[model samples]
Target chain A: MDDYRELKPEDLVEDPAFRAWVYHGTGAEAWNEWVNEHPDHAQAADLARNILASVRGELDSFPGSEVKNRVQRILESLDAGRSGTHPADRSANHRDRRLWWQAAAAGLVLAAGLGALIYTRLPEAPAEKKSVAFVRAPGTSDQTHLEIVNDSESPRLVNLPDGSSVLLKRASGIRFPRQFAVAKREVELSGEAFFEVKKNPEHPFFVYAGQMVTRVIGTSFTIRSYQSDATAKIRVKTGKVSVWAAETVLTASQEPSTGIQELVLEPNQQAEFSRSDLKFALLENDRPEVAPIPIEQMSFEFRRTAVSDVFEAIRTAYQVDIRYDAGLLRRCSVTASLGDEPLTEKLNMICEVIGATYREKNGKIYIEAGGCE
Target chain B: MRPKLILQEDPVSPLWQLLCSGDKDAFGQITENCYKPLYHYGTKFTDDRELIKDCLQDLFLDIWEKRAHLSGVANPRPYLFQAFRNNLLRRTRRVSRFSEIGAEDELEFSSFSYEAEWIHRETEAGLEQKLQLVMKQLPKRQREALYLRYYENLTYEEIADVMGLRRQAVANYLQYGIQKLRDYWQQVVISLVLLLAS
Candidate 1:
């Protein structure tokens, strides 16, 4: 309005409330008035609001207990301000250095002896520890490496490129490429990652795990597809995503021979699939039917499963291999959460219940029967 | 000097002095004074509570840590609010939580702005609750614009800068909010009149 043009800066100075409203609302109508009357006051008012906001926000959202604890530990370490083993004023003279070498030599000898004794006395079995091998794409950097530490101890934050963040769950490992390609962004995930994807409409992000793939333009979601589980699942926390199984079987008579079947998912929906049988099952807000039957079935009952699967979860979950002394393969059933139990403990527990002993050698666990009938 | 003297100095002068001196107490007092209006600004802009909290918290922490190096904080409130506003925009660049809600996702200001002496004196008892009820009845854009312009004293250009809209758009939203609030109050007054007449 012309009247707004005519308004003087004095008008705003006389009315602080009006000024507050104008500034608060981001209205420029009062700008002319504010500048005309009290140009300095306009800027002054702006600074006051900003400073107040910063301080209030800090006091309001002070770090949570965990973050505070971590910061406190770091600060406490700073107070000591040294490799605490050495005194601050100590000089590394030749004599002192010699004494250190002597002490180190004596300690090494004692430690070697103790280690030898402990090694011989502690173990009854020579078991092969299975290690996970990550097959990364070419040109992947060592800095992009992800590790899942499971000691029932603490949680960790993982840093990622593209400003997209992921909080890795405990005991979960994920491997992603260091530099994301413009055409596609993909990560091989085992365990779980809560992903906050940067929205780029041109380049949609894809998460690959076994036969299932999760495609998203921009969204927040969680995926848990450990090799230990029969079915991999993708859960969306916020935003939309397209989930699909890449390896589905089709007859020759079918027009399209490709094995891809796309399933659109909204928030809170999960897409689950069994890679062996090429069957897909979707679950929402609840656990899907992962396995066909109950765990207590007689004879080895596998529904939509493969016998020659290398990372057979049943073998790990029950802790007993199918081979009975490397001759007869006992068909033992398996179904349960393996999260709480160790691989060795689970096998031992199941073996004892089924009247069998597990023998381990060179890393492979074998089931031996005592002839229960 | 006494705390009273500290308060008596021109607000801008004291704030500038305090910031230069790296006085944490002064920083905290400034924040305590400004938080409500800033919060109102944040809530009005984005309905995502978590995002607002994150942006606001990050903005303040940034200011406190960087206070020693900062220059030209003549009015700390605008700078702080502006910073918060910028943080929100940057954080929401990838895809905002509020984007999906479209126009319907207006910030519902439920909290009480109890610090305003004039509002309290006029409303008497349960003013905060009444304000909240009245706020709930406001149109999404109107409430948002009102909280930012009236509560924060931001220029229309500044609001446009924060909201990533044209200056004219901010002006329109501000006028709309004020008109709606006035209309709502007039309706209340009219209903009371009608009840008395009956």
Candidate 2:
């Protein structure tokens, strides 16, 4: 309606009422009359409208059911919270009772697994269902846990926020905090689940299956602790791993007493901790074909390469820290054909000829030698 | 993030009134009607679907709890828009453990992807591409204004309220935003010149 004599394409685009007039039939007759009278500016007005119209891409059309379901959940949670009947209430009584119930449930599932492998037909779209299980990490008294269960008849895949993937077997469940624990990445496993962990050295991942705790730097492995089975097992598919048994806790203040012997397992190796004796032992993996590929890909074939470069490559490949006297090892150069051997074998093969002795402590590979000279 | 425009801008006056009077059915209707748009709008600011869902849940809960002290708004779209923007700004900042959430919080704006919107539109084959690139190059504030104006079709005052800017500022942002888009031709010219120089 204002004078359109000096309006640039940009000016026309900026004008809301003008854009409305152009696109939404706002003052269409008056704008048409003005455009007919002033022929030169019509193109700019049209261009401005085109750009404005194109600026609005189709918005995402979400299914209404998702919104309704979400609203219903919030309303239900609010109602429960008002009635002091929230299931995830952090009271001591609630926590202890829930813990007892889960523990009993875990035992029942384990027992049931042995009796009936009821692989019921998986529910349609199993990923969409939210788990009702709320688990809290053992050490952190305050944070709530994000628990996921594979209730379907078949395996269900879960992707964690930290890039870890879990293939949870039917009737299996895992629980970790919504955000990982500050000191460590810890999750509790009740049944069988295969974890493909993206390694973060600072946040060492721990999987507490029943009373046995399996620790790793970064690797793919499966842990099994069905309710009927007295032994919890950890099989390392890649990278270095250590496992130790922790005494089961019945009280709140119980710490995982460290006096139990810790056993380190190499690739293609498995460890089982007997729940009765609370002892862990290393054994060869039942399946050797699958574990060798990761080891082969992480091969160290150094031809006329500096020892430091070799160690650097190895360190980067495995996400393990190799603490050698950089000053001492910098001068040393060695050539070796390292194949798809487990981490320990490769270290031993490289160190045997180089006069270096390697030992692992706290998940780090330490190379000790006099000197290259 | 261009939310799918809910074409149903039907007079929501009755629903708003019913909701303000503590009607749960009206609340459900509002959620069903607005959830997609709100979700799509939230996605513009963050790709965290969980965060988006959480913000929406919090937004509806807060409104429901405080429905007792509310005024009746005829067109509830703008009110809901304002509430969503405020709720998302507060929650996202607090989620990041911000010490204090202030006016600067709304500065966490969503960006537009023009390619997603690119239609054959009978323009030159790659004209849409150039336009998209130029649009993305606009300043975030200007883009916010343009989005509110063009996408949400908000008036200058409504945009001012949602963006927490003055009416004048909103006007300036729209002017500058479009000017920036129009400058894409100049950019194309400069690129041609550079190509010739090379």
Identify the candidate with maximal DockQ.
2
Query: Model 2 over residues A1-373: C-alpha lDDT tens digits?
Result: 4453566767666565565553334454455456558656654664565456335422342434456676777767667654432223324332111132223223222222211211111234244333222121112222254567766655555556565766676556776666764556767776777666766899887776655667787777778776445577777766777776543311111123335577777766777777656688776545642223232234467787788887887665455678989887777887887643435556777797678998878768889997776
Error of 2 at A348 (Å): 45
Q: List the residue pairs that clash in candidate 2.
A: A59-B3, A59-B4, A110-A227, A110-A228, A111-A228
Against the hidden reference, what TM-scores do the models get?
0.27, 0.37
Give the top-scoring candidate (TM-score): 2
Best by lDDT: 2
Candidates 1 onward: DockQ, in order: 0.02, 0.11
Q: What is the interface RMSD of each candidate, in Å?
A: 26.4, 18.6
> Which TM-score does chain B of candidate 2 obtain?
0.71
Candidate 1 lDDT tens digits, A1-373: 3333433333332244433332222222344344346533433333233222211111121112323342333333334543441223323231111111111112222222222222233344133311121211111234433333321223333444555655555445555556665565656554555666777788777765544667888776677665445566776656788876532111001111134566777766777766444355777545323331111111233342322231255443232344543223334433332222224444565565545677766446666665433
Residue A88 shift from truth in candidate 1, angstroms: 36
